[model samples]
Every structure is written in structure tokens, then in C-alpha cells.
Target: MPEQTQDDTGRDRDDDGRARNARPRDRFGRPLPFGSAGVPRIPEDLDLPPAETLDYAQRLLDEGLAFNAHEVLEAAWKNGPFAEKSLWQGLAQFAVGLTHIQRGNAKGARTLLKRASDRLSAYGTAPYGIDSPGLVDRAHTLLMALEQGKPISDTDLRARLTISH
Candidate 1:
């Protein structure tokens, strides 16, 4: 069993499977739940190689840190070749969708997922070392589940999750 944390009123919020955190975090820069005053910018001089960026993104996603993974993908979109910018944008949006799922925002998740699917669909089966078809299928499945009221387990999103090394 997972450990539960106390809310402001000292109630066990996680006990009821409340993935969405309701407590407003502190305004100070000090670390609080879901509150970051500012995040240090990534150095523009540090160029992240495409393969290394993909590797980092894959690891973050596997660890269920899709939110962080989206940052990496977004960086890739901005820094990567112009020809592949859309591909990275699609992947970033997909990661953001997964982040929405983790944050318990079903509507947001479905919206971003559908947008990602539409963007990635242009790639067909493969693009930028990713299996676009499998990703599109998974996106569709999750979107449909949200639409059909199906229970989505954390691991329900299983598909081509790795990048070619």
C-alpha cells in the first residue's frame, strides 16, 4: 500500500484515489507541492544531441515523468533540425497529454492526445526513430477510453515506447 499524505485539514486525500492535488501551494520560491516560482533556464550553449535527447526522454517517460519528458521533447523541437521540428512537436504534445493523464485531467488529456495523434498521423509508421503508428494507436486507445468511460490503469498506455539507439 502507498503511503498517504495529509491535506491542510489533515485528511488523507490520496486514500480516495484523488490524483488531482487541490491544495494551493505556497507562493514563495521554496519547494511546495505543485508550486515552482521559477525554473532555471537550460543553457543555450549546451547542445543536446538528438540521440541523447531521445534517450533522456525515453527514460523520463518510462519513469512516468511525462511532464519532464515533455520539456525535453520541447527542447528538441526548438533545437533540432527544421525538417523534423513538427515530429518533435508532435512527440512533445503526446508527452504533455500523458502528463495530463497523470495529473487526473481527463479532458485535457483527451484534447492533447487527439491533437498529438492528428499531428503524428502525418508521419505514418516511422519518423525520427519512433514508431509513429504504434504511438498513434496508443493515443487513440487512451482517447477512446476517456470517451467511453473505461478505467485506465497507469500502465494501459503500452506501445512503441522506446527510441532506436
Candidate 2:
């Protein structure tokens, strides 16, 4: 038989007396129940090269997997020290906004898309070149439609640029 200790509340304690084997606390010191702490951290060894990261983002976008593309690009954007960091960050935001649009959340999409457009516009053609300008324009167009309470028209959008979905 195992020996037990007694807590201040007269509860029988386990060998370690580790708060009665309760779940770990969060940053705010609130108890987080077991298995509810959310996703695990990404390993440092899993980091991809810049070119491969960008390729992953493009592939996901081309496959009509906007959410996955956003995740990939966002990770790259955050980790990158590229000369075109602002451009990539804006693109990542645009991808996330598009994901929201696909999910029918017009307001949320508008907010994120507007931020992307603004960031890209600030970079302008000087540092980000023509590509940033084009992305900003696309984001602006989408934001306008969303602000007007109009559904994004696939035909109209497709006419301007070729997005996978």
C-alpha cells in the first residue's frame, strides 16, 4: 500500500502533492483542464527555407485551400526577415481575409483585407514593386464590395485576376 499525505483541506494527497493532480494553469493562472490547452507548439526543426515557404503558400492558394495558404504564409511572414517582408505580410493578411470571405463573414473579411491593402499601399512600388501595388488594388476592390453589403461576385472577381477558387 502507498503512503499518503494530508493537505490543508484534509484531502488525502498523492505522493508529490502536486495540487491534487489538477491541470496546469495558464498565463493568467487560471486552471486549464486536461487536453483543453489547444494546439501544440511547432518544432524549431520544422522551419522551412524561405523559397520553400513561399512555394507552399502559392501551392495552397492555387489549390483553393485559402485557410491553409493563410496559415503557411502567415508563418512565413512572421518568421521572415526578407526584403519584402511587408509585401508577404500583406499577402498573408489578404489570404486570411479571403478565407473569411469564403466562410461568409463579410465584416471580418473587410477588416483584414483593408489592413492588407493599407500595408501594401504604404510599401508602394519603391520597395515592394509592382506586385505589391496589384495586391493592394485587389484588396481594395474586395473591401469596397464588402463594405457595400454586396456579395463578392465570382465573375467580376475572376475578370480582374485569376484566383484558384
Candidate 3:
């Protein structure tokens, strides 16, 4: 076997010594071989305004790439202003809940969907015109379907992330 590089945590490290996986990932965000073609990655430092972030994440969701959408939402949560942390975090978790459904983890999907709903409920007057209550309803609907063992369709999973202006 070829020699392997070692890091303090046995994970890949970036130039700044931060744990960073350089492996490419598929549409569902599963890591692939180093040289394999993969979906374009969302930057870890992506810092878009709320509207732009929602637009980008919505496009990803429409493409049935919920995992990538989660990455974009997670970046927003990390880089957005502190006041909107819960909002972004809930959106990220919502995307992740969809991802878990796609990956066939119904239990995890249900848990995250419920948690996202709970978080979003606290933001009835969410910023950037996000339909927080709508999202919470969607999460509850999805969670119920999961609990009842109903097969979830792509159309049901890919609801608009924001309301029309």
C-alpha cells in the first residue's frame, strides 16, 4: 500500500490546518474517489445575501440535490449575521431532512424534519420574506408521511423555499 499522510485527527487538513475533505461528492453529497467527476461543490465560505442564498438553494432542491442544498444553507448559517442564526440553521436542517429521506434514512429524516419545524415556528416573522410557517407545515407533513411509512415523492419533497413576492 502507498504511504498515507497523517493529521492530528486523521482527517484531511487545509492550508489553515482546518479539517477539510477534498474528496469530490455526488449530487446526494456522497464522497467519491479523488479523481471521479462529481457535482460542483458549494464553497464552505459562501456568504450570499438571504435572497440569493434562498434562490441558489431552491435551484439545488429543484434539481433533487437536497444534500448540496443543505451545504449552501449551512454556509449561510455560518456566514450570515448572528441575529438570523436560527433561521438559517432551520433552513439548513430542512434541507438535511430532505437529504436523509433521499438517502433512505426515514428515522433521521423524521427527526430533522420535526426539529426544523420547531425551530422555524419561533420565526413566524422570518426575515427576507421567507415563508417560515409554510416551511414548518411542510416539515410536519413530511414527518407525518415518514411516520406512516408513505413513500415520499420528489415533487412533495421539493417545495419552494421562499414565498412569491
Candidate 4:
């Protein structure tokens, strides 16, 4: 088969002379790239150590800003060493699940939260700090409520996780 050629308008003419749109364009008529825009820019001179990543996640949880926390922790998790990667990944999933719950998407929350629990459960709450087990327990409890067609109370959830008032 011969190679087809695309014109400036992104229309390609095959050997059989059929013209087809080769690429999709954005709303402003610019051609969309194949991959994501780009990786988020990380500071080259970042001073915070890898161990502090979980601390940031905890603070996000405390402030009820799970989504942003997930973003930060996920990046750190990916770049972290293999030994502790699962732990960080689990925390990121947990935070994402809580964010879903906050947005009233119990189904989505259940999926990610279950994954988080499963991943974290294996370690038996060793490296995850003092409140780690409580957070996991609270996430599981909320997941059960979501599964059983019960409404979850914000106060109850907070108390279960021991998030101080």
C-alpha cells in the first residue's frame, strides 16, 4: 500500500483518492497535540524532602482539600523509591476518594477508596503514622455506608478519622 499524504488542512488523500480528516482541531481551530499539554512544572530547587510529602497530604486532609493533596502526593509517589511507593500511592488514592465523596460521587469514591484500603492494609499501619489506621478505618466505614444505600454524615466521617475540630 502507498503512503497517504495530508494537506495543510489535515485532509489526507489515499491511493484510492478518498479524502479524510487526519486530525482533530481545538475550539480555536488549532490542531490538538497527541499527548497531554505537558507535565506540571516542578521547582528545580524544591527544598522539601520526600518524607514531607505525606505531611502535605495530611494537611490537605485536615483542611478538607483532598483533590489538591492527591495531585501533590501522586507526583511524589511516582518519583519516590520502590520500597515506599505503594504506601504513597495508597494515600493518594485515599485522598482522591475522599474528594469524590465530598462531591457526592459515592460510586467513584468507593472504587478508589477500596483500592487505597487494599494497598494500605498489607503494611498493617506501620509507616503510616499514628492516625493512619483511623483514616483507613473511616474510609472503609464510609465505603460500607455507600455500598449499603445509606447516607454519610460529614460530622461522623470527620470524627471517625479523628480530624480535630
Candidate 5:
């Protein structure tokens, strides 16, 4: 047998030798074959303003791309202000819950939704115009539907991150 090429970490690396997943991913963020064309990726370093982050994430959700939305929210959570970390993290969890539902992982969906609800609840009032109470209610509704064995459609799962003025 021929010797296999190996790296110290055995992980994919960027041209500069930084670790990164260079694989293309589907709209759901599942990895595709190396040569297959796939959905564009959300940048890991994306650090948009709060309103822009919410808007971009909301658009992704509307497109039934919850996984990508989660990435955007995760980036915001990681790169945003400390005071708003919980809020962004909660939004990321909410998106991931939807992503789990899309991927047919009922248990994961339930767990993530519950966690998102708890975090959103701590806000008490809307922060950055985010409808935290509505999101908490939405999470509870989705959990109830899941428990009842109801099917959640992609359209039904799309969430509005902010209150409409």
C-alpha cells in the first residue's frame, strides 16, 4: 500500500496553514462531495451590527436555511459585545433548533429550543428590538407541536427575529 499523506493534526487546513473545513456544504450545512457545488458559506469572522445580523439571519431562516442562519448568529455571538453574548447565543440556539428539525433530529430540536427559550426569557424585555417574549412563545409552541407529533413545515418554522415597526 502507498503511504498516506498526513498532517500533524489530520485536519483540513487553509493555504496559510490555519485549520478550516474547506468542504462545500449544502443549504442545510451538510458536507457535500469535494467537487460538488454547494451553498455559499457564512464567514466565521462575520461581525455585523446587531440590526444587520438579525436581518441577515432572518433572511436565511426565511429561505429555510436554518443551519446557515445559525452560523451567522454564532459568528455574532462569538464576535459581538460581551453584554449581548447571551442574546446572540440564544438566537443561534433557536436557529440550530430549527436546523435539527430540518435534519429530522427531534430530540436535538427539543433540547435546543428549550435552551433558546430559557436564554431569551432572561431578557424580560425586547433588546435591540428583538422580540424575545415572542421567540420564547414560539419555542414553546414548536415544542408543543413536536410533542404532539405534528409536522412542522419549513414555512411554519421560519422565525421573525425582530418586532415589525
Candidate 6:
């Protein structure tokens, strides 16, 4: 495959016909050269039951599809009942923080994680099947690791996060 250049502004045209500039991304929104041809997207109606909505985000998170998971959470935040908006927003911010990690933006990741932690903390733990306490704890830990110059990976994130009822 030819190397990408400044002139390669056009999307998805490669010399060897191999995939390039594909829009499909990993959980953190980083472009992946392969896989995820069929990532699940949220439906038009945001009326899914709480369990189902959380389940979808958990599945995406477990698969290292953090950005995809964020889409689900963001939709819920934007479209779900007003009372639960903060919870959903926190979840979306959490996923976005992970996306920042994927993008190798440590500062951004820390900032988002801190903000998410604060927001989710307001809802307390076990709100609508989300473990805000656990999420905030892990977010702080990850932030500490980043502060110490430790590297993070999808595998590490998967090991740390577990969405539960």
C-alpha cells in the first residue's frame, strides 16, 4: 500500500485496493485499518429500557469499542428522560475520556476523566445500572497512571472496566 500523503485528501482510494481511510473506528474513535465492519449503532428511538441501553454500552465497552459505546450513552443523555440525563452524560464523558486515551492525548484524557468522575459522582453508585462509584475510582486510578507516565491500552481498559447492575 502506498503511504498516505498530504495530497491524499480524498477518502478511501488506495493504490493496492487495500482498505485505507475507512471511517470505522475503535472504541476510542481511532481509525482502525480492519475489523468492525458491523459496529452496532443506537436506534432512532431513545425509548429503550434502562437495562437494554446499559447493556448495549457494556457490550461495546467490553469489545474495546469505547467511541461506539459513547454514541449510545450520548444518545441516552440527549434523548432519555430529563431526570437521568446527568447519568447518561457522565457515561458518555467516561467513554470520551477513554477515547482520548486511544488518541494518545494524555492531558485531554485526564481532564475528561476528572470531569466525568465529578459528574458521575453526583449520581452516586448504581444509578440506572451504572456503577458510578466504581467508574470514578477506576478513572482516578487511570489518571494517576497517566500522571506517572504509564501507558494505557485497550486490553488494560477492558481489564479495568466492568459495567454492572
Angstrom error of the Cα, residue 106, model 5: value is 0.4
lDDT of 5 by residue, 1-165 (tens): 122243587767655566677679988888898788999988766889988999999999989999999999999999988988888899999999999899988899999999999998985675789999888989999999899989998767968899989
Candidate 1 structure lDDT: 0.71
- Regions of model 1 farther than 4 Å from truth: 1-46, 163-165
Candidate 1 lDDT, 1-165, residue by residue in tens? 344577677555566655433333221112244444444322323358877777777877776667667778888889888988878888888988887777778998999998889888985654447867778888999999989978887688544445445
Q: lDDT tens digits, residues 1-165, model 2? A: 234567889665666664342344332223466666723322222356666765666666565556566666667667777776786687778877877777778888888899888877886663312356666677888888888888785433321112222
lDDT of 3 by residue, 32-134 (tens): 9889999998877788888899999999999999999999999999988898989999999999999999989999898889888988998668988788988
Clashing residue pairs for model 5: none
- Candidate with more favorable, higher TM-score: 4 or 6: 6
**Per-residue lDDT of model 4, residues 71-164, tens digit only:** 6668767777788778778777887787777778888889999998887786565453424576688777888888997877655445222233
Q: Which residue pairs of candidate 4 clash?
A: none
> Which candidate should be chosen as best, given TM-score against the real structure?
3
Greater lDDT among 1 and 4 belongs to 1
User: Of models 2 and 6, which has the larger TM-score?
Assistant: 6
How many steric clashes does model 3 contain? 0
Task: Score every model by TM-score.
Answer: 0.69, 0.59, 0.92, 0.62, 0.90, 0.72
TM-score of candidate 6 to 2 decimals = 0.72
Indicate whether candidate 2 or candidate 5 has the larger TM-score. Answer: 5
Per-model clash counts, in order, read 0, 0, 0, 0, 0, 3
Q: Against the true structure, what is every candidate's RMSD?
A: 11.2, 10.9, 3.7, 10.9, 4.6, 7.9
Looking at model 5, which ten-residue stretch has the lowest summed lDDT? 1-10
